[model samples]
Target: SAPVAAAPGDNYVVDDALTGSRTRWFDEARFGMFIHFGPYAVYQGQYGSCRDAEWIKRQCNISWSDYEAKAASFNPASFDANAIVQLAKQAGQKYIVITSKHHDGFAMWPTRVNRWNLRDHAGFSRDLLRELKDAATANGIKLGFYYSIWDWHDPDFVGNFPAYVTKMKAQLQELVTNYDPALLWFDGEWTETNPTNPWSEQNGEDLERFVRTISPQVITNNRIGKRRLVDGDYGTPEQSLAGSPPSAQLQETCLTINNTWGYAAWDASFKSPTQLVRDLATLTSNGANLLLNIGPTPTGTVSAGQSGALTGMGTWMAVNGAAITGAGYTGLVGQPSWGKVTRKGNKLYLIVNSWASTLHLSRRSPFTVTGARVLGSASPVTVRAAGDGYDFLPSGGATNAIATVIEADIATPA
Candidate 1:
């Protein structure tokens, strides 16, 4: 008889010890910064017209020797860890996840497992990860590491897969032991067909288990084990938003600010600050966190366009952050065409994207609206009982042009 398959939530049974305070912190951290800095940044996501990104080495089909040579000259002189963390705080991001090792197989931190790392190969003086961890700690921000399981530079990856896994484990041990990261975000688990990527489901499980043994307190993502709901502590939907909440109790959507995850000098298409704020509200409404990405330039500085967008977002978060941070899904009111809804206790925040003179709630809504007011403003919104249900009328136009949040006080139905 075929082996019985595990139930929906049984594939990766988390140790009760792992999901204590750390998991709670993660759930409450509604927004975070994802840094994609690697050798690929040197290329600026361009190879003539190919438009390569973090996968520039594979996408452009560059020879290994050429890639290595280019990597040797990689030196980011202006990398400021404190400044980055400060920016995160300004943007109302409680946490950050930076790439420790991308698929290119270059470790940002000094690693003894291999010389193909920042300190040894690139001849860089500073420990990038250590600087970030220290800055994050000082700024009261949680720091996580994003490591790619696939290795393009490792010679043993194709010939002796287990040897590669052992090296990977050693590198991971270094990160967990030295950095003490709050989270470990794994990626590059997909089994591609071209060279026949050999990453297997069992590998993911074993790696996850190994991570727990070393640091039971750290949170990990589904990519650590087969990209399934049961693989790790939470589900990670990349490059796009999840249409609905995933089967995993905890989910995070990772999206790039521009078209590419790595620094693309020519890619000027960036989402407006209003759109990002709205995205945050939408994700929070579904009980999901948003991990927005930033691709730093070769000089180790955020581009003007990216930083400007982040500044704009920071401005909005300064005013209406309560609507996002620590907020969760509230089924009392269905999603309205005007905007999204998020709740914290008896407070239901209406993130109005399209301002209207009046907002209506159906009679069947599960909660009674007691009062309403603009989130960041001193003025109160008039709440009245209507024949159909409840009506909310703001005193004036939206206080914020991007997305105006109205705090609605509610009482549970009897």
Candidate 2:
């Protein structure tokens, strides 16, 4: 989504002090866990060649009545909220964001506004949101909710646009007041595809205003109105890292561990742990948070392959987390051929994804190094002045299996 510039004299301003604090906390928490589990898990994106299982109703072109019947059978008895939170903690994620309501309009929590939610319509008797929220709180992990504005099942949304907006507000009130999510990731604001009835950007802004009134501290994404960087607290870049590094707003890069955001029975192509860590490092160096997603199976359990990948990432974070946490783009230069760079205060962390006994910095670096050492270890790396840049010679044992983080004490040019 392209970022839109802020309008002149816009009154919809977030409290600067609160926004600054929240932004700092968000940036320091570089990695977050994204769960996309819903009734769609039952379909697993297996309807023909469609990959988004979460949108199976639309993908399969199922009638509303049939989809409602399908919701009646939805039961995730094996869902272990504590287990999921534990796995996220093990993966070194500072926050967890789960889908309370996807585009399918199936609310994970009990809602008074609609009976189509999990507690009222589906066979599940438990409130998934409450369970996950409680577990996240117990574990000291910040919790966020993903809410989609488009609801195919709601008749109000189908025929009455204004009524639909009111219902949406009521539901948002329920979520914010009951659960208190740290962030509210809104989607489907561009529900303009429906030729019969189109949702407008003004409606989105009004909805956002209501959300803020209820929960002023909650962070929101740009997808609510005009999918743009300045539209919300952060830029929600999904699937790929295509945009130039976000400067005016907080930035997040959301990606699935595999090809699909929702679980797919036929989709087994999972990204390697090494690649995941590299992406995390690269995003961190670019001053963006990585919201890595894991689509749980229909049985409410994360796939073994996905868990293994996260575990591998945990191993990497165990050693080189200093390079990520509380770090941001150094503004030294673009990402180097070898890897990336993140900075905190006077320290520069050179993340070496491709190991070399001797590494050379770009001529863009204007700092003199007093000392160099591998992060998380005291093993020193020899640094000497090159003509324009600097060269780092690693002491034999100063390396990590995935990415070696070298911390340099830099003296900036006067």
Q: Which predicted model would earn the best TM-score?
A: 1
Question: Candidate 1: lDDT of 306?
Answer: 81
Error of 1 at 220 (Å): 0.5
Candidate 2, superposed: residue stretches over 4 Å from native: 1-17, 48-52, 191-193, 227-230, 363-365, 376-378
Indicate the worst ten consecutive residues by lDDT in candidate 2.
1-10
Query: Cα deviation of 375 in candidate 1 (Å)?
Result: 1.8
- What does the lDDT come to for candidate 2? 0.81
Q: What are the candidates' C-alpha RMSDs? A: 3.2, 3.5
| lDDT, model 1 | 0.86
- Local distance difference test, each candidate: 0.86, 0.81
For candidate 2, write residues 1-414 as lDDT tens digits. Answer: 122344453333333345656566787999999999888887767756555678788888877877777678878888999999988888889899999889888888999987888889885888888999999999989999998888877777778989988888888899999999999898887746766446676776676677767876888887767643126678788987655553656789999898888888877898999899999988888888999999998878899888889999988888878888888888775567898888887888999988788888875757678888887777678998775688888876536778889988887887
- Candidate 1 per-residue lDDT over residues 102-219, each given as its tens digit: 9899999999998998889999989989999999999999999999998888978888999999999999999999999999999988865547468886787788778878897899
Clashing pairs in 2: 3-229
